[model samples]
Target: FCFKILNFPAEHIMHMAIGTSLSIILVTVTNSMYAHHLNKNIDWNISKKMFFAIVIGALAGGFVSKDLAAKTLEIIFSVYVTLVSIKMLMDVKVERDPKATKDVFYWTVGFIIGFKSTILGIGGGTISIPFLTWRGLPMKKAVGISASLGIPIAMAGVASYIYNGMKISNLPEYSMGYIYLPALVGVVLTSSFFARIGAKLSHNLDQQKLKKAFAIFLMLIALKIFIG
Candidate 1:
């Protein structure tokens, strides 16, 4: 009985790691395609910076304990993200202005995205998209940038989880900290193909519609976290 219970956490960690990694790949590919066809003017520098920032934040968040404090933080982040999504949903049109996006804003947002990604086990692109679109980036650009940003977030989060798991005593077999590799694999496999599809679809849909759909999705996820 003790052995069985101990094995449970390992299984969960495997699942999470696999799910998140695949999610990162799928989202990245989707965003790349969307940006290519929809937004001709791509700023690779900004995308790179956002990606690193997300990684750092995710690493930090992943190492933290999953205790009350962590849970509280997660709740706060979920509420904040949900509100932002709702606000974006209310806006019918996104004003596009490349000049309006500042370096400071990107970094700040990247940090938030990274932290959220690690704690929530989600791609920061979900939040980054709305914020970037509101700041004047085209939806395509925002999605692309957000998708790029997820790479670092996943890398950092996964690494940290593995590191932490190694240090802790009595971890289950196949355990790698907070991540569940098996679930991670499952999610990644399923989501990657769909993410590519999503990216392709983004080209056919208007920015407003995409924003609305994304916002609703974010809200639902946030709600689930809150309930959990």
Candidate 2:
């Protein structure tokens, strides 16, 4: 729906809003379910922090005008995020502290994940998972918590996009702002199922290998966006 929205008639802002809203709803629901069924021991404090970061980041990212400048920013940010993902993957080490304080490290990690998630369509797991594991949480626990944390990130990011989209002038038809319903529906329906499968598979894989694979996938997507 997002891609369609990009090409939709300039007068359909409401449609775009609807599509973005629906996409976020779907993302949240799927993430919640994954958390419940897969990771039942989430740390509420960390989850709350991550959620707040998502909201702030989404609000900021969503408000940017959809112009040549915005597209440029998107490409630049994508490359930066992809590099960060690769760095995290390469520097993987087993975390030894599970009850660490909410210090500078925690906030820095959370902010990066939230900001990148807002710019990209991802749920922030690509960054969150490795950070959590590096902070000492078990891989299963990190995945579960990250999945849960993703709900708020999607909600806030989509909401921001929808809200800002409503204010866009001369937007395309069948768009609410930056959203396109049909595309959103298709992606959500397909991605949700695949995300669940991925979550399940994470449990059976080697943590380091999984992180590297995810990092590579993120980098590829970033390159695609940059080239597009």
* Among all candidates shown, the one with the greatest TM-score: 2
Off by over 4 Å in 2: 1-29, 32-38, 64-68, 103-112
Going through the candidates in the order shown, the clash numbers are 19, 21
Report the backbone clash tally of model 1: 19
Query: TM-scores, in order shown?
Result: 0.72, 0.74
For model 1, what is the alpha-carbon lDDT of residue 24?
51
Cα deviation of 200, candidate 2, in Å: 1.7
| Reference-based lDDT, residue 23, model 2 | 62
> Model 1, 183: alpha-carbon shift in Å?
1.2
Measured on C-alpha atoms, candidate 1 has an lDDT of 0.63
After superposition, candidate 1 runs with Cα above 4 Å error: 1-42, 65-74, 100-102, 168-173, 222-228
Q: In angstroms, how far off is 225's CA in candidate 1?
A: 4.7
How large is the C-alpha RMSD of every model relative to the true structure?
5.0, 4.3
Error of 2 at 125 (Å): 2.5
